[model samples]
Target: MADLRVELCGVSLKNPVIPASGTFGFGREYNEIYDIARLGAVATKGLTLLPRPGNPVPRIAESRGVILNAVGLQNPGVESFIKNDLEWLRSKTKVIANVAGSTIAEYGEICARLDGLVDFIELNISCPNVKCGGMAFGVRPESIREVTAEAKKNCPHTPLIVKLSPNAESIPLNARAAEEGGADCLSLVNTFTGLAIDIERRRPILANNTGGVSGAGIKPIAVRMVYEAARAVKIPVVGMGGIACAEDAVEFLTAGAAAVQVGTANFGDTRACLKIIEGLNEWCDRHGVSKVSDLTGTLVPNA
Candidate 1:
């Protein structure tokens, strides 16, 4: 069997497949289907300093090959998560705490609170559908640097990962900024800002009017952006967007991602992550690849 183990910022993962934040939701629900410990890591839903009720109704809208979400950052406060979900999840597998805030100070507060409690603290700076500080800090390279630095300072014991937004001016620039600001790792292409309209109603499907777009439709663009950002930064990059299967996961690896995150696919199939993991093993065995990590950054540019 091929070796599927990979490391991110010195933390070793059993494999490179992680359930993206917001999609896996602390792994309790999924645990009913399979052992959560079988996967590489579980990224918790976006956590805030205080509990958030999120946005209004019709938060999720489906379209051809993709989905739009304005779910906001609806999550139990960090305190509740620490008390409720933290240890249970940690015992299952590696825990990556996905956190968000409405202010730069709040980012530090949450990071500090979760410091040493989770394996990784993923800073959610690129949520497009939110009305507050999410996308605001992610759009510019300057703020990406500033907010990342603040979060990193607060969480010295845990690895800090800055999740970059696809709605930014330049993926490479924002990636470099996070690297400069002390991000131990980077994850990208967090949903593109998109709008879906109801033809008969002549109104946007989501109550927020606009939402972050994700799913299979964003794969190509996500792969390209991942390639660009990976080339720009020295730190490890975790690629995500529209990944659905093992082949999709391999594409991100070839594009320079140390690992990949599965998001919307989980909505359609509960076993998507596990299937991808099994598929990866099969694919590697068939291709004669001894270690899956060898596939990273193996893309050869067209001459």
Candidate 2:
């Protein structure tokens, strides 16, 4: 057997498989189906200081190999999570609290509240900074640095993982920006901005008009972007976009992801993360590798 354990920002994970935020939902519902403790970590749904009802119906739409979503960061709020789900989730595995907000102060406030409470705090930079005319904080390198710095100042205890948006002008530049802002770690390629249309009705499919695109179809592009981001930064990168199987994850590892998060796969299979974990063990054994960490940045490119 091979050693599957890996470390992220000084924290030990049994493996490199963490379920991405938005898809896992705090790991409660899935815990009923499988032992979610098998995962390296569970990134909770995007949390805010207050609960959000989310976008209107038609929030989720399906297509070929990808899906579009504009769920609007719906959640039960930070206080509700601490009071109800925190303990139970902590009992299972390491917790990665994913947080979002409408302003830098809101991000700082929420980070302060979660400090020392979870193993890691992942700043979701996708949310719009309302004060900036509703422009998302993750679109440019400047905003990424600003929001990450603000959040890190408030989270003196827990390590801050800035989750980068894929819709940026330059991913590597943004990755470097997050690093310069004092981010302990980084996770990316958050869903890409995409549009799906109802041809017959001549209307947008999702109520929000446009949605974040994710799934197997985006894996190739995601892999390339992950490679770009990982190569440009000294900080560890948690690559996530359209991973569905172990092989897909191995590609990310080869491209230089220290860890990988499984997202859309969970919506289809309850035990997708576990299955990928098992597959990682087998692949490592077959490759005569000792530790899975050895596979990071192992890809050999042709001249």
Which numbered prediction scores highest in lDDT against the true structure?
A: 1
Off by over 4 Å in 2: 127-135
Residue 87 lDDT (model 1): 89
Q: Taking the tens digit of each residue's C-alpha lDDT, what string does model 2 give over 1-303?
A: 889999999999999999999999988789899999899999999998999888887988898999998888889999999999999999999999999888889999999999999999999986431223123888889988898899999999999999888777888999999999999999887888888999999999998888889999999989988899889999999998889999999999999999999999999998999999999999989989899999998888898
- Candidate 1 per-residue lDDT over residues 1-303, each given as its tens digit: 899999999999999999999998889999999999999999999999899999999999999999999999889899999999998999999999999999999999999999999999999999886778999999899999999999999999999999999988889899999999999999987999999999999999999999989999999999999999999999999999899999999999999999999999999999999999999999999999999999999999999
Worst window of 10 by summed lDDT in candidate 1: 126-135
Off by over 4 Å in 1: none
Q: Give the clashing residue pairs of candidate 2, or none.
A: none
As a TM-score, model 2 comes out at: 0.97
* TM-score of each model, in listed order: 0.99, 0.97
